[model samples]
Target: MANETKKSQKILIVGGGTAGWMAANLFAVHWPDMEICLLESSDIGIIGVGEGSTPHLKFFFDEVGIEESEWMPRCNATYKNGISFVDWSAIPGFNHYFHPFPAQTDDIFTVPAFFSSINARMQGHNANAHPDHYFLETYITAKHCGPIPTENFPFGVAYGYHFDSGLLGQYLAEKAISRGVKRVIGTVTEVILNPRGELASVRLDDDSFLAADFFVDCSGFKSLLLQGALKTRYTSFKENLFNNAAVVMPTPMYGIIPPETKSTALSHGWAWKIPLTTRYGNGYVYSADYITPEQAEMELRQHLGLLESDVTARHLQMKVGRVEKHWEKNCVAVGLAQGFIEPLEATALALSFNTLSAFIKCYEKGGYSNQFEDAFNNEINARFDGVRDYIVCHYKVNQRRDTPYWKDNAANTHVSETLAQIIHFWHRGGDFAKNLYMNNLVGSYQPKSWACLLAGYGVFPPLRSDEHNAPAPSLPDMVQLGDFIRRCGLNFSAHNQLLDHIHRRPA
Candidate 1:
């Protein structure tokens, strides 16, 4: 088999969501001489529920030479410092916690204190290890401040964004098309494979064929190229991760839009509240095995105080897992066509961006051949599994024992060995960070993130009554810590102020 050079290569993207346009834009920039074209159907409808992003999205825009000022305002986007999780646990003071993206300041002060607190608590001493108290980002979120640190702030604060997914896809499509990437709006009715069993081209509904050197599958769950055409194997995480359905609803915005997505635990699942400039994206994610779609819709509506409102609910079924091979033959899967570990961490776009970035590097390194596809698949599979482990940790260590869904999650024995070992190491007071680093288990989420999830849920042993008079653990002073956080908070502006400034600029 002969490989084509970049100048002679043409890449065809099957589907047009955020993933497709992102692929087109990335290829246009990275392989400037490679011809890239994206095909999408007007018949396919994308979910309009507002979507949240990870910090990676900001980097994605940067990689594509787009500024936040240009994209955010057009997408009805709002700044997001982190996520505020409420009512996931029933422990007295642990009912609420904010999970912030790690900051550079964490290394100097907050993170060490956090690890010490967790270690002390593991030693049977009462040390406050709540994650919300130990993060500068949490303080910023609580104060409703944007994450852009002032010029002299000296420390970097990571942030994401909340946006309407549909609008974002459209915006990216326009940007890609303007940059010489061809956009063909047509449905792919058939896939044609070359004699080598790789994707040769796709047959559209109009009885025409589109050929390319490589194919990218962004065709959503139908997976027209990778799985459907290539026959790639799909693995399911249903045993450990039970949530497979979501019901989304929109509500009008109110005063003081905070710079954080809010996730609240409900009976059979959790509800997410994503704040955007135009409206609040609300949704309930649950397992249909334990609750019906109607029940989930009612629960979401009631939870959001919209039981009587005429707003209709949109339902979705999610496939929770990843493919055994992300890159197969000459085709690579992106977005839903690849895999989904659920959107609990708002990682959909981020994962897609990462996968595409890695694929671009590996594919280019191999001279457009499949030389490094094995390594790419290995790395991506590990990433998908790692994310799944983290999301599963939220359920496995949840403090609620009230509902069967949660209880079953808590007692489920289907977890991966790595996750079990990590949890066990946490309980045994081993250095959690070292465990992750030693095993090379740290993927996208950091060790502090794992600590946050555990400590935020108030997972701890019973405090001993000094055991006939032992020394108390020297803990960081809460008052002093609070003051330090407040002092640091002065370097940021109010969420509304920043958003207004960003929005006021015309895109």
Candidate 2:
């Protein structure tokens, strides 16, 4: 007797936004002979506010053969070095900090050592004793007007992009179609399931059936195939992440576009400003329990120094959670269909890309066995849970007492056991590099990121005897680092100039 296991050949992707097109293009690129079909409805509108991204996006672009010149101009994209957080703590002028990309230096110190040097320097009342002094990317952002052009930055500059999300989807769609992936435009009316609880096919509005060996759900928050057909439940993170809604709008660039995303802490939540080539993608993410959509719009307008009539805002009810399982049977959910945790760190696109990449690898190697499915589930769950904890850390360590929202969050924000353990370890002067919870095999926010948050919130660990008594970097060494940053900034061209240069070159 022979085994009767099904092998995925024809893949039907239901959804047509960034996640759908990304999956299609990735599949088409790696498995050129495989049949990949993407279904998108012309009547549906995309929630295109995910304008910021992590460095991982560069890998996706390279894999799909997308040139910066090809998509940058088309999407009004701009370079991003890292994120600058303002007023997260209630320390007045002391609250602002930069969570820069990893420094490109061999002399990087451990978190405790770095913090010790900063504290020692601050004790001497040296005006230049800030954390930014230790990072070269900060200088690149301050002087070069953006990140360095090279992907491999020997100078320790790591960068990503801030672009129009809708335009990115269109760009990926064009590339995918050019690579021979089929595209169908229609709304899904029904999801058909087989007896074994597997996705059999999907019915379009025209009453036509589209069947495939496997289904990929990029159907945004609806989870059409995975949750709708397979009946997968969602695990809400509302308790951990309290922001349930957002009001998004774009404003004209007032001055030169900065090379970093700006996240300003609001009374109830936070406002993100992502500078593109032409306009600024802005949004205020807030908890509805503390404020209403109409009030949020008013607050956002005030924050941007705009009147009610200056700009039109789009209100969105955010679904702050993920599905019970990212993959079940033959159906896998990606993008918003998988889950969302606001846009605090711009993990939306990164998460989708990760799921697609992992799924493809698992299928190619193991052919989707029960063992492989279990492994895939564990991996995605860890990713989502890890992200959730990191985001919660930002809210948990805040010392703000200005508003009810901040007050409540500071007092009542829940922390997972994993995060709590990591915090405890930090308190004991443990090295962050040794904590598995702070770092992962696949994700953005690393232990260094956590260190930034902890430092910003003034949550330093007790100084160990070795660290407290250790010799700090000499004043001359500090001066040299500052001089290097200044020179780097002075040597790099302005960000707008770089954009102009790229645009002028023949594509």
For residues 440-483, what per-residue lDDT tens digits would candidate 2 score against the true structure?
Answer: 42244566676667766665433345545555543436566666
User: Pairing residues by index, what is the TM-score of model 2?
Assistant: 0.90
lDDT of 1 by residue, 183-291 (tens): 9988989999989899999998899999998899999888889989999999999998999999998999978888999999999889999999999999999999999
State the lDDT at 36 in candidate 2.
Answer: 89
**How much lDDT does candidate 2 score?**
0.78
The C-alpha stretches of model 1 lying farther than 4 A from their native spots are: none
Model 2 residue runs over 4 Å out of place are 1-8, 106-130, 149-153, 368-371, 430-444, 460-476, 487-491
TM-score of each: 0.98, 0.90
Which lDDT value does model 2 have at 320?
Answer: 92
Top lDDT model: 1
